[model samples]
Target: MTRLRTLLVLLVLWCGVAASALAGPIYRVTVDTAALAGQGGYLDFLFLGLQDAAPATATLSNFTGALEGGGVTAGDASGSGAGRVILGNGSGWNEFAQHVGFGGLFGFDVTFEVGGAAGDSGTNLTLALLDDAFQYVGAAGDIVTFALLPGQADGVTTDGNFATVQAVPEPGSVALLALGLLGMAVLRRRSR
Candidate 1:
């Protein structure tokens, strides 16, 4: 019975450690397309691609747009046009959206399917630009996807971390975890 109890406790502790280590990455990518808007032609186009080489590509869905002062009334199409291969990975493409009129900005969330159970730490945002006439007229605007490092709350923006992410250790969380483990040890000793 004592050995069983020790085994159970060890299993629980191992599970806790494994769970924490297994947590993956999730990013809320907000693209400020206000700059891209009204550049040459009407900025009515779609941007879509995968974060990694996974067959499952993430889609930036449910667009909500606005102009500087007024609402130009635009919406998302099903990205189903003669889209060209945007990413150099030979990733074929199709129109993801059209009539996404000139707006203040375009925001989309790309939840990365990262490495292992720890999830994707980073992925590339390979985008192709199409004209108002469904022609691949512009260059591919490829950018890297980044998420704010763990335990950070403010000050840093997710935008600037396109190239490299500054990840920091959460000291408070570590301290709390240590305290909890110590308390658990005390309880186990008392029960014994």
Candidate 2:
């Protein structure tokens, strides 16, 4: 009877651990506009568009954006397509306007998750930078393509060029995990 009780408790704890780890994949794409500065001195607009092809079980959501230096999302450019421009307007071409001054950083991140029992075998996402007229501006290296396979432990691939794409833990979750680890370490030390 005692052995059966111990097994039941272990099973419950194992299930709790697995349930806590269950979640979709998160990716962070940080664009170094500074490297593309030679292509243009002023980044009038950043094309925050994504072209993706994913497994039927996979879906994308929770898109977030940030900017360094100066710029704003042009409402007109908020959609999925090759011509979408999510950054500054035509006025940004001039030195006086609010724009990412070539040397600034533009960040775009997305979450990919498996919505069905089939699971996400793989997914591809493409990101780009565009001009005021919604024309492609960056060079080959500046443009990045990410291939994510949720099935794998570390399932993110890229050309590894000028652009930066990485998997990051959610800030709140990471903080909580750090606190838990510290508490465990303190308890272990006290027991010793």
Candidate 3:
């Protein structure tokens, strides 16, 4: 019985250590008009670091506008095979304008749009965070840095880039794990 108790206690300690080890790092980023903007649209990009060697997937939400209010949805650009302007990047800085909102515990939302003469054409660009292996990790509040590329209707201009960071718990639930280890340690000491 005593040997069994000791083994259980050791097992508990190992689990606790493993849980702590799995607590992945948190990264975040945000962009505002100050970074990049134009007469009718803007562009923002975020970059995040990967915690492990495992591959990560990145997801993007709608973009919110700051001034002339309008929500930018994912849509293909003129003659471009790209999926959507708001979500993916291709050529020029794409217009992004909308109120940023956190979708839920796992994701958030941004706004984007385009404005200029009917025939006027330009591009907005934003980069997604890539891991060492060049894999994309979904953009969350925990972003490391971001960039804002201005639209080029006829010229380029420097604008504001507003961003924010939020904390997110590691993927796995490891709370209360310490308490379990403590109980096991006490049991082992008592047995000794």
Count the clashes in each prediction.
Answer: 5, 0, 39
Predict model 3's lDDT versus the native: 0.35
Q: Which ranges in model 3 have alpha carbons more than 4 Å from their true place?
A: 27-161, 166-177, 184-192
**What is candidate 2's lDDT per residue for 111-166, written digit by digit as tens?**
54432222434433345565555465665433655444445543444444446777
Candidate 3 shows a clash count of: 39
The lDDT values for all models are: 0.38, 0.44, 0.35
User: Which parts of model 1 have CA positions greater than 4 angstroms off?
Assistant: 1-13, 36-95, 114-125, 128-131, 134-140, 143-192
Looking at model 2, residue 58 earns an lDDT score of 19
For candidate 1, lDDT tens digit of each residue in 1-192?
Answer: 977976776776676666656543333434344445565322232223344432222344333444222212122223321222121212434223334444244444333223322232222333333456644433344333333222322122333312123333434446448856885887888889
Tens digits of per-residue lDDT for model 3 on 64-169?
3332233343332221112222233332233232222222111233232333334333332343332323343333222323222223221212222234444444
TM-scores for all predictions: 0.38, 0.48, 0.32
Superior by lDDT: candidate 2 or candidate 3: 2
Error of 3 at 91 (Å): 16
Which lDDT value does model 1 have at 70? 22
Cα-lDDT of candidate 1: 0.38
Q: Which candidate is the best by lDDT?
A: 2
TM-score of 3: 0.32
RMSD of candidate 1 to the truth, in angstroms, is 10.2
